[model samples]
Each structure stands twice: as C-alpha cells, then as structure tokens.
Target: DQQVKQNSPSLSVQEGRISILNCDYTNSMFDYFLWYKKYPAEGPTFLISISSIKDKNEDGRFTVFLNKSAKHLSLHIVPSQPGDSAVYFCAASAPHTGNQFYFGTGTSLTVIP
Candidate 1:
C-alpha cells in the first residue's frame, strides 16, 4: 500500500483566490508533517510544517492543517499569485525514522493572472 498519496494531481485557480491541496497517509507512526513547493527542475523548498502535537501551522500565504486521527493533511494558500504556480509535495516523517522523509506524488497548482 502507498504510504502517502495526493488524490488530485493538479489544480487551477485565478489570482487572489484560495488554493487548497490535500494529502493522505497510511502510516500511523508519521508524526511530523511538512509542505514543500517546487518549480520545474529545482529542489523543493519548505513552505510550512505542523508537528504531530499541533493541528495547524501557518506562514504568510501558506497554512497547513494536520488531522492525525484521519491520517490526512491539507495545505491552503490564500490570495494565490501567479508566482505560486508550482508543484506542492506533502511529506511526513516518524521520529524513529532517523531523519528520513516520505513525500507524496505532489499537486501541481496553476494560478492564472
């Protein structure tokens, strides 16, 4: 079974709108959740993260909500901009995994100006 999955591979939204990306995990041991944004060939840049102890975390235009009980998490971007068009990956890691991170396939967001 896949440990992590993002059902929607892509999303399109007009500028200044809200863009939401969702992710689901099968591993119950995952305690650290993170969101990363990537452009074309570049490495993903960390956007926001929520620890297992917390249900939500936000940074400027980015917000991440974690539902541990449901093994689900979502990333919300408000007032999306054309520059925000990129692939977003949801990642999770267990403390015992020793710094290893597992990433979902990713959700590509296109913000039209």
Candidate 2:
C-alpha cells in the first residue's frame, strides 16, 4: 500500500533556487520524512541527494539533481514496520559488575529499512 505519496508527478527546479519537496502520508504513524539523501552511490542510485553548501541555502544546491538531470531515474520507496508489539531496551553496567545494571524504558520501535 502506498500510504505515503508525493504531491507532484514531476517537477523541475532552476539552477540556483529552493526545491521544496512535498510528501504526504495517509498513515498518521509516520511523523516525519527524510529529505535530501546524504551521498551518491557508486552507480544506478535511486533517491535525491544533496550535500551541504557554502551559501547555507539548506537545499544544498541539489547536487544529485544537477549531475543526473539529463538521465531519467526511478525512485523506489518501501517502508518497514515491526510485526508485533515488542519493547526494546538498552542496559548499561560496570565493567566487572554484572548485577548492577541500568535499563531504559521499554520503547516500541518501527524499523524503516
């Protein structure tokens, strides 16, 4: 199910301008979406990647967009989630003390792979 969707089918941005990508999701569980991927892959990559710019425009000048604008690429999105209700905890203890440990509160986690 494509719970999360994009606003536009296709968009074109200028060389030096802001590109605001709008993403909408039908499910309320998704609180945020990761925008602007970090780095480019070796080859045949899928996703928009923009690096930090000197001007600090925050759009990062759309590095991947500028480089690969000539070629058409497909973007694949697959959201992952936990199957059952499980609590994940992280505990810490001294080097030699096995019994003396501290545990964090149980938190339900959904993994997006």
Candidate 3:
C-alpha cells in the first residue's frame, strides 16, 4: 500500500494564477505533515508544515491545508510565478520517528509565463 500518494504526476498553471497540488495518505499515525519545493538537481526545501492538531497553515504565498478526517492535504500557491515551476513533494512523519519522513513521488508544477 502506498502510505502517501500524489495522484497527479504533473500540473500546469499560468503565471499570476493559483496553483493547487493535492496529496493523500493512508496512515493515520502520521502526525506531522510537510510540503517541500525542489528545483532541478537540488534537494527539497521545506515550504510549510502543519501538525495533526491543526487544519491549516500559511506562509507568505504558500498555504497548506490538512483534512484529517479524509486523510488528505493540499498545497496552494497564489499568483503562481515562473520561478515556482518545480517539483513539490508532500512528506509526513510521526514524532517518534525522529523526524524521518515518508515522501510522495512528487508533482512537477509548470508555471507558464
């Protein structure tokens, strides 16, 4: 079973529009959720995170919403820019795992100019 899944392997959006990426998880034990943005040949950088206790968290142009009841999460970027074109990975970990995370394969977002 895939504990974490990003159904869409890629997404396309025009610059200045909103971009939304979705993810799903099967494990309820995952208490900490994170979104990471990765550029080519580089490691993922942490974007936003939310604990199981919270439903939504936002940082600047990025926002993450967690729906615990449905075991789903999404990352939203408003006014998407060409610079935002990259792979986004959703990751989760339990506090007991020492922050070791399980990652989704990834979603490549292409922002058109």
1-113 per-residue lDDT for model 1 (tens digits): 56889999999999999999999999899999889999998999989999999998889988899998899999999989999999999999997888789999999999999
By TM-score, highest first, what's the ranking? 1, 3, 2
TM values, all candidates: 0.96, 0.32, 0.95
Alpha carbon deviation, residue 86, candidate 1 (Å): 0.2
TM-score winner between candidates 1 and 3: 1
Which ranges in model 1 have alpha carbons more than 4 Å from their true place? none
Candidate 3, residues 6-64, lDDT tens digits: the string is 99999999999999999999988899999999999998998999999999999999999
Could you arrange the candidates by lDDT from highest to lowest?
3, 1, 2
Clashing pairs in 2: none
Best by TM-score: 1
| Cα error of candidate 1 at position 37, Å | 0.5
Residue 54 in candidate 1, Cα distance off native in Å: 0.6
Candidate 1 similarity to native, TM-score: 0.96
For candidate 2, write residues 1-113 as lDDT tens digits.
54434435433333233333343334332222223222223222123422212111122232221112221112222221222112222222333444543323223333322
Tally clashing residue pairs in candidate 2. Answer: 0
Between prediction 2 and prediction 3, which has the larger TM-score?
3
Instruction: Supply every candidate's count of residue pairs whose N, Cα or C atoms clash at under 3 angstroms.
Output: 0, 0, 0
Q: Which pairs of residues collide in candidate 1?
A: none
